[model samples]
Target: MNIRQYLDSTYLKRAIQAGITEKENIKIVQGFVREAIDEQFKLVMVRPEMVAMAKKMITDAKSQVDIGTVIDFPEGRSTVEIKLDEAFKAIQDGADDLDFVCNYEAFRNGQVDLVKEEILKCTLLGLKHHKVVKWIIEVAALNNQQIIQLSALIKNVVMTNFKEENYATVFVKSSTGFYKTENNLPNGATVPAIIMMLENASPLPIKAAGGVRTYEEAVEMIQLGVKRIGTSGAKAIADGAVSNSDY
Candidate 1:
């Protein structure tokens, strides 16, 4: 399969997250962007501050690689206004996609309305700007029932608020790749969790993030109906090997 088109070549680590100097981190993210351009990958998913850089790089290279950024990344605790502001700035900086972390903790705490409000507002921002919006559900942090319910909740919100022709602009993504788990389990999208997302959030698109680091694994995700695979391993996947990228 043409896996490159399905990969959002990702590098979301900050200087502290990867234990590198800020300069070094910028260089690494730049390298990732150039690689995405070279490989004709679908998108470059980076930290919000780097959206402009990705835009400039793709523009200078005369490439069509889309730029994407995360909102309330790794953790979904930001207020709705804060998330919207972040999304707006990224959009202004030429980002074509935005993935906002849904308040899974709020949902688990029975604050269902809070979760809905957060999703609704952030989604409206993306829709208004005509950017692709994906809700990161952080499946690793929830039980099976919660995953199913939350998936349904996101789908319901998208269907209720968006036009039928614009459903492609909305996505129910699997994880943030940073949520801590008991027993230190993988925090990204797993096969079972992805299957659950596909079954429960149908009609909405799926983007499987985290732990997808090889061509074979990415193929598996696409076969399971994921429209996008977010990974730091796009080059490795293009090379047909296991990626050592931690993000």
Candidate 2:
């Protein structure tokens, strides 16, 4: 089997959720990223505050690492203006990609148009700076109807802003690691319902995040049409799990 192809086939957004609390941890995470770069991995997503630090760490690295920052984060409670400002700040801090969480509460309250408008605003904000935008439509929080509506809204956004080349991704995520309890969402992006959304999305990329911890899970997500895999366990996946390796 072609291991390099598997590692290089999809976009892997290495998450730095735990390293944001201190400068030392940030340095350690940067060292980890250097190793990923040595392996030819190309993307890294960090918290809003760590963009500058991450940029400094990889500025002279050999790999083409694109920095990403999250807006409205896991809760999705911010106003459109606040989210836009966050995106702008991340860009100024040297982020190459913006991952904005959708307003789940607003969508659940039946505010479909309002949700689309907020996403449109974010898309515009990212495009103005020539940055890639990935809309994290948290599928775990949405019902079937909301998913269908969101899918259409994303398609519309991409079609209307042809020059911008705005990209949208459906993320099947668990609780943002804040809670201590176990999560129900499966590892990787291969959940049946998520696959259904990908099949319906057509053309747009699917980014599988939240619980991906092993190579088997990663491979499963790729087979299910996921174009990107978001994880903090990239090294473990690349090394291969003892029980799950097919090689």
Local accuracy of candidate 2 as per-residue lDDT tens digits, 56-150: 77786645766766777767778999998888899999988777887867878878778878877887777778887777666656666776667
Summing lDDT over every window of 10 consecutive residues in candidate 1, give the lowest-scoring window: 175-184
Best by TM-score: 1
- Worst lDDT 10-window in candidate 2: 4-13
Off by over 4 Å in 2: 1-21, 163-190, 242-247
1-247, model 1: which lDDT tens digit per residue?
7789999999898899889999999999899999999999999999999999889999999999999999998788888998999999999999999999998888999999999999899999998988999999998889999999999999998889888988888999998887777897888989999999999998999999998878888898999899999988888887899998765
TM-score for each candidate, following the candidate numbering? 0.97, 0.79
TM-score (C-alpha, index-matched) for candidate 2: 0.79
Candidate whose lDDT is highest: 1
lDDT of each model, Cα atoms only?
0.91, 0.62
Query: What TM-score does model 1 achieve against the real structure?
Result: 0.97
